[model samples]
Target: MNLVPGSEGGFAALHAWAIATAAVVAAGCALVGTLLVVRRMSLLGDAISHAVLPGIVLAVLAGGRPGGFAVLGGAVVAAVVTVLLVQALRSEGGVAEDAGTGVVFTTLFAVGVVLASALARRIDLDPSCVLYGVLEFVPFDTVAVAGLEVPRAFLTGVVVLGLVGAGLAATWKDQVFAAFDAEAARAVGVPVAAVTTGLLAATALVTVASFEAVGAILVVAMLVVPAAAAELLVRRLAWMAVVAVVLGVAAACLGYMAAYRLDTSAAGMIAVVLGLEYAVAAIVAPEDGVLARGAARARLAWRVRCEDLLARLWRADEARAGPPAATGPGDWAAAAWLRVSGRIVRDGDRWGLTAPGRAEAETVVRSHRLWEAWLGRHVELPLDHLHPPAEWIEHHLGADVRRRIEAEVGGEESDPHGRAIPRERGRPNA
Candidate 1:
């Protein structure tokens, strides 16, 4: 398993193993993190990632190999203790859960640091590796398996990933039920407490498995960032978990390669790459993302401007006057668009609605006056106050709702402001 000097194959194998280990461990963290995020326990994941360090150090001190069952057991126990402490502080001492978690995990992490530093010789725990991890050296520690030298960290990661994935899969329904509404789930006979405990244990197991490859500091990024990003990208719990795992694995691979090229810490680079993924996800997510929301707003604004121009021209024609002056850039753009789209035409110095344009303009004006009449009839709003609400709502009314409103207002022919309500044109709203 040792690397020979100037060995290209050896170095390539080493890098592959390291990236594989990171990807596997990242997947495990992402799976567990999905439930954590769904249940709003992401901070608890962060707490457990740091607090498990003390248990790991103690386990190593008690003669457990780094990725052994003994070490995993110790981590689970520490994770349980951390949760219990946080709850106790919340219930008995009236402390906030987040504040209590912060206090407990930091204190335990500090103790682990002191113990690791003090017992460096016996425990052989390096402080630098404890924080940032030594991903570059992961391949160096190999265990012989089936006549091949395999990295122990990679093996541990695979095992942890399988375990966490199976455990979550078996409890997916209950996990979701408990996540969205614990009280309701408890009322319906779900084992909310056991589910929560199992999640905490899984968090510890994955955190410890990732210790040698990505370490405590970067592990939280693997756990929370991918899940958070996936949440933005998908709505279903199953798809969210799948997307989170994919994102985590991608980050691990890309981040490791980037770190190798940059001669930097792979763990730090992986975290950075995860942050970048979240940023991209926030921008491009299907709904509620920055781009999607902005596009929706822009479309609405454009529609409003165009519709306002049409309604204004229609009213001018009704008033037996020339077109209104294009006061703003929006009006100018809208008028030009109307002309280009054959919705309006230039008649000398005035703009006139085309045949189709007059019908569409009548519809807009009809929707506005219908809403205003409905509000005046139902809401008892004053004459002057009706225009603004009706104006804003005119763009949103569909044909079906407009008909219903028209019916509710007893087919009123005029709004409260004495403006005649335009006929419906006997067609669906465009």
Candidate 2:
């Protein structure tokens, strides 16, 4: 094993091969996986990969070489068989869809296991390699195509990916409808069963092509996780597929490099790298991630709450002809934080807003008072109920939306509670 981590030339060649191989396979898997996920048939993709092993073993036993035409033929057959058997179990045997898939694929996988073990000596089949092919050794299997030595696996995967891509493009509308709602598609005579069978076959072909480069087990991660992550980060299905392909290719390249650096398996490294990508998306996704949007919402809510407290304190001060002599329990805590943040000041138990605090406090009061006036006009809610509802909505209303609401309420100058509605900030003092 030349463990010196291939030279730059060797590394570039290896990287190119890995990227080409992963891109083609990942695109197909993620594309189909998107449909599977949308239709809630993700478990079916899992079952198809395992179940196709027997068909491939049989093809090989019947004089078919691994990575040759026979394996692909058998794979499609196995995929179709798995689908049919699952359907049979669901309709005839009265089993649940998932349970039927479990029974069908597990049995097929066991058969493949027995055959691979029994025929190990007769064929170029290694049981471990059957489950997870030797990706590092893939570059060693060079085939001369038009006098250029290229990794056979890379070439084969590219061709398969092209075929899948072309086929999908040709039938995208039908497939999209089927995926969105199979029963509706069926009702409209969209041949849902045939479309489903075609999808399964495409998935099986992609799986087999990738099997040599990344193995069967990890392909599941590439197929599903990228699509799943992309779904989290994108709304449209087309964009989701695009994002998944990008993520898949990136993870493959990064994983391969990391594996080479650390002297580990490339497939395992890719899976780990993909997992990290998903963790990042979960934490940093805009509008949805746990950290980014949550923090943003929290900051906005806290700011609104603090401003509300300030405006209330300001009202108390106005009623007494000076700064408030005593702030409430909630406002006192808010005032302390505001004072520490230089947004407010306290002198001998009296509280007053700083220059910045006055602007912010006025905005809150404007939003609250405007909302109360609007509710009094448009809603049947009582005056007392207005403050609590406005208190919550004040965080979401922007300056423009507030202005629109202000117009809708006929430029109301006072809330239902008769307190003056503060003027918009950045305007000269009235």
Candidate 3:
């Protein structure tokens, strides 16, 4: 392909070809990976990737070139055999799925390595290339397509990607159903077995397509990492697939550039980049990410502290008592924040609620007492137990919910504790 251009071009052309090839391979892996992740069959994908090495070696020994149709066919057969073995072990031998996967893949991979070593003199395949890959050398192996020389690896990746994408599109609904609930999907006539077999075949195709770029070992990261990251970022399957492909492509480009600059392995760099993407997704995911959930907890805690302080002040005012003690650091901080926010004000040496704060405090007390009354009527809790539940529930009840509780408790004037339930903010008391 002459990717390196001297008077014609430069190494820029080679770098571009390499990066593009990596991106294509990554995209295909991500597509298949999305389904594997969703179906919890990621280990199966890993198994297929390793187990297919023997097939590739055998195909090469049989005069099939790497990244060619013959190699791909052998790889798919190997993948199917791997899956059948796993199923047989689970059903007949009562071996666990994970154990079966481990046993089958490792054993097959060992056999492949032995074959590759023994036949190294006869085959064009390199043991190092099987483990790591020869992406740098991919540009040198070109075939003419439509009168234009293109890298063989890239062409195979594109063809496999298109086929996998088309097949999935035609049966996305069935795949989704089977992934989530295979038994139910089968009951509904969704052809669960066929769908699963198709996925295994697709996994094999993508694995082999990636074999020249990332190799058999690192291809597991290409297949699983981006899809796992996408699952964290998105809720829907279609969006997850789209996000996974985008992430995988971006990682491929960045990783290739990084490897070029650092003078390291492109496959290793690509796996590193995918790990970084997953880490970023885990930290920043919307609902369940560490940062998001932490922030939510902080916000709720702050609100609860503020409302608790307000309700305490209202209770003191009702009892004609002095200001509540701000004994703890949290209490003092909440008090200072409430005063600065205009919810509390300085009155002589004590703190008092502002007009708006009084209204808010009244609502809180109303919620608390109404809940206590409702629990008293509905539950057989002791009067002492009523206060603790109401105390916690006070912060969560909205005006509408409080009003409903109020009505359901017969518009109680007093709680089970014999304390008067404050009226709604705008209601007049006779």
TM-score of each: 0.95, 0.78, 0.93
Candidate 1 wrongly placed segments (more than 4 Å): 1-7, 427-430
Q: What is the per-residue lDDT of model 3 for residues 232-349, given as tens digits with 9 covering 90 to 100? A: 9999999999999999999999998888778899999999999999999999999868899999999999999999999999999999998888769998899899999899999899
The Cα error of candidate 3 at residue 294, in Å, is: 1.3
Clashing residue pairs, candidate 1?
A: none
* TM-score for candidate 3, residues paired by index: 0.93
User: For candidate 2, what is the lDDT?
Assistant: 0.79
lDDT of each: 0.90, 0.79, 0.92
Say which prediction, candidate 2 or candidate 3, comes out ahead on lDDT.
3
Highest-lDDT candidate? 3
Which of candidates 1 and 3 is the stronger one according to lDDT? Answer: 3
- How many angstroms is residue 200 displaced in model 3 relative to the true structure, after the best TM-score fit? 1.5
Ranking by lDDT: 3, 1, 2
Better of 1 and 2 by lDDT: 1
lDDT of 2 by residue, 338-404 (tens): 9999888876657778888777777877887889899999999977788888888776678988888
